[model samples]
Target chain A: MLFLIEDAINGILMGSIYGLTALGLTVIFGVLKVINFAHGSLLMVSMYAAYWTVALTGWHPYLALVIVAPAMFVFGYYLQDIVIKPIFKAEQDVREPITVIIVTTGVWYILDNLTLLLFGPQYRTLQDNPLRGRMLEIGQMLISVPKLWGFAAAVLTASGLYLFFQKTRLGRAVRATSLDRQAASLMGINQYKVYNIAFGIGTATAGIAAVTLVPFYNVFPTVGVLFDIKGFIIVVLGGLGSIGGALLGGIIIGLIESVGPQFMTATWTEAIVYGLFLLVLFVKPSGLFGVRYDW
Target chain B: MTRRHYNKMAAAIVLILAFGLPLVVRSATYLHILVLLYFYAYLTTSWNLVGGFAGVLPLGHAAFVGIGAYTSTILYLQYGISPWIGMLVGGVLASFVGVLIGLPTFKMRGAYFALATLAFAEGIRVMVENIDRLGPFVLNGPRGLQIPPLKLGLGNLVFASKEPYYYIILLMLLAVLALTWVIARSKLGYYLNAGGEEPDAAMALGVNVARSKLTAMAMSSFLTALAGAFYAQFTLYIHPKSVISLDLSFEIAFIALIGGRGSIAGPVLGALLLRPVSDFSRIYFGDTLPGLHLVIFGVVLILVMIFQPRGLQEPLTRAYNRLLDRLAPGQTKELGT
Candidate 1:
């Protein structure tokens, strides 16, 4: 029972980060209606950026986010401006989404391979970092400091995103565009600008998730492959564009991964998480917290 | 003369060249490349069955490849069965899996189907990776099964030379093309396209969307398994990474997409054109820069999707028709058109 409690705590912590990862993908899908297969690669880019910042100059990981998030937002904005806008300016259909999805897959390969070329395939871990390797114990239960901070950061940013969506004019426009692109444009929302900003925000979320991750995870090019698959599963479970659903789906998946190993073999935990994902997809197609889709 | 007669003559000449190429080119490396090309041609052609015709873009086709590779290898390793027979057995088994997977997946559309299929593929991969725990003697998990080398014979399907593999794969490609040719003109193809292009319209027109999709998936899986079995026998090795990874899935789908989707010549031409670039890049510069070929493929895939969404077939066909029009007025009615 005590072990189960620890698992639950760990699950929630990791799940929050998972939620952050899925949020990037969810926003892209919500705004552009295109699944950003390269979102994981963008996360990889953020981690590498943070790694270099810490390695080159003495700075906290959180301090590095100040540089990273804005840089990433600009990059994503350029991506939308350069490639996505010309294509996405027109309305999308079923087949068009598949084509756009494949384009993101191409983007993934480009970024991932370039990273492999630059950084090599070897893994890097943070050393002497403040968020590295310390734990707190309350009674018989122990909690890792890094994950705790990561979880806090995730919650803070997620709420920040929630408030932005609720209050800001740009955020409102993004929500309107997602609800109906034609109708939104008819209402004087410049979908071109909205798409660009939404993509930027989507990529900024990746930067946020990456900062939270560098404390514990090994940094590598192909590391994004794991998050890519997991993010896609989370997005699907959350019913595509649903924000709260992404969080709930991420938590559910994390819990399954954590608690599943207690009963099954440790290796099968990955499989169990995916299995549960498929189960949710088939059984509850609308998602657990089926709230407003884009908002 | 009619354009039909001209087309038949062109086909016969191409067939003659294919049969006679081994006589003129004796380089083993070139033959190896050619064999690889034909192999991919078969795989991609089969892939277009579901991807292009049925419009269910599966990103998890590697499941069939792994299953086919493992089934025949295991049968040969444990039961001493010839791969010729074992390939057919593997094909049947893969088709069974196809049915099992397709039933639920048919309910999904577009991206949902693609994601679900990918999940299914990953699920199978995880299972295959861990199955050795139950009985290591069978699945062998990660170590993978290796087919012992054997003497060359028609029955054995083992070759002392590369020519046999080349010819066999070419024949398989030709068979697939012929199959595609027949299906393209048949009611099934029309139904597939209709279902893919407009499901509501197809249903209103009395097409059974689920049944047609399942059949296409079954055919596709069977052909993919045959290709997989052939790969095992040709390489004399079977492993999860080579046979089952999503990379294999991407190549099959992307090659078809790059060449042309829903066109008979698209997949073969796509494989023929791009496979050489991939093979040559891997052979020459693979060590110099990791993933150079993949980078090229990714760029090409994006460019093709953005710029040439219909693939190379459109321009090539246009050029062909223009050429025919210049040669003889009003004599350019093509087969597929």
Candidate 2:
């Protein structure tokens, strides 16, 4: 019973972080109306950023978020403005431009291989950090301190995002553009600017997720590939564009990965997750928390 | 001669050169590269049936290739079956899986379909990696399966020389290209084109767009699996990572798109252009910069998409027609001079 409880707690905590990792993907999808295939590469870039920040400064891992997030925001903003915006302009009539997907995929291959060339394939982890391997214990239970911090970060980020989207002027402009780009344009909102901001926000969240992961995860050029697929599944399961749903979906997957090993091999859980994803896709193409109407 | 005759003559010349090149290029290294080039051309052509004609990007065609490679290898290793026969069995099995996947996925739109296919392929790869044994069969898990080169000949499908593999893949590419040409003019071809461009309109016109897409998927999967068996025989190895990989799937799509999807000659042109670039880059800079080729590929993909959304085939084809017009002014003179 205690083992199960321990696993569940770990699952929830880890799951929230997974949700955080996928947050940027959902945000980008919500506004761009296209699945950002380069989203994983962005995560990878941010993780490297976080890794270097903490390693070089000898600061707390979370403190690295201050620098990484803003930097990623700028990177994503220009990426959209310069590389992707042209494709959007060409396919303005298309609700979801397939060519943009290909372009993002191109970005993915470039970013990942560029990193490989620059940093080599060797995996790096932050050693001797303040939150390296700390454990929290309460009544025969032991939990990872980094994961707890990750959980707080996920909740805070999601809530903060929710509020920003709901209350702020820029947030409303983004929402309006997402609802109807042409109509928003007619209302004098620069839809292109909104797109840049949304992409920036999304990439910034990936940076935040990277900071949380740096304390616990290994940093590598291809590390994002691992989470990239997971982010896709989580976003789909939680419902694409649903902030809370991403969190819930991540918890579900986290639970499966954590508790599933009790009865089967660790790898089988991967199959189960895939199976569940397909089931959701067939049964509810809109996703668990997504609206029935197409975005 | 008429323009049609000129076109046929051109095709014949290309074919003859393709067949006779192996005679002149006796070096084993170049032969190996040529064989792999033909192999990619064959794989990309097969991928074009669904991805190009059906207008949906199925990024997981590697799943079918993996299925074919594994089926043939396992049958040959355990059951003592000839790989030639195993190849057919693999093709059939892949077709079934393809249809099964296409059923639910064909209902989805662009991004959803792409994601679903990617997940399905990843799931299959994960399953293959985990299962070392399934009842009587041994998958060897991540260790993969290796075929011993004991038997040799056309019948066995294991060759001692690279020329045999080159000729075989070349023949397969020609056959698939012919098949694509035929399909492009057929009723099924028209239906597929319609469905791809405008599914709702196609359905309204009684095109049975879903069924046509599924049919194309089945055919594409079968052809792709044949290449997988060919790959297993040529390399004498079968592994989850190499045979069933996202990179292979993406490469196929990249070739199709860059060469111009939905066109018969696009895959061949793409393979011709991309294979040499990737191969030579890897050979020259592999040690110094391991992933430089992929970076190049990404840059090329971006550049081509940005400049020529229709692919290189369009410009090349137009140039070819202009050349033909200049050469064969006699027909125009007879008609109007």
Candidate number achieving the greatest TM-score relative to the actual structure = 2
Estimate candidate 1's alpha-carbon lDDT, on a 0 to 1 scale.
0.83
Clashing residue pairs in candidate 2 (N, C-alpha, C atoms within 3 angstroms): none
Q: Which stretches of candidate 2 lie over 4 Å from their true place?
A: B330-337
iRMSD for each candidate structure, in the order shown: 2.7, 1.2
- For model 1, the chain A TM-score is 0.94
Distance from true position, residue A283, model 2, in Å? Answer: 1.5
| Global lDDT scores for all candidate models | 0.83, 0.91
Clashing residue pairs in all predictions, respectively, total 0, 0
lDDT of 2 at B165: 90
Scored by TM against the true chain B, the candidates give 0.96, 0.97
lDDT of 2 by residue, B156-250 (tens): 79988998899888989989988988898899999999998888899999999989999999999999999999999999988999999888888
> Candidate 1 docking: what grade?
medium
* Model 2 C-alpha lDDT per residue in residues A1-295, reported as the tens digit of each score: 9988999899999999999999999988888888999988999999999999988989988899889999999999999999899999988988888888889999999999999999999999999888988999978999999999999999999999999999999999999998899999999999999999999999999999999999989999999888888999999998888889888888889999999988899899999999999899888988888755473
Every model's TM-score: 0.96, 0.98
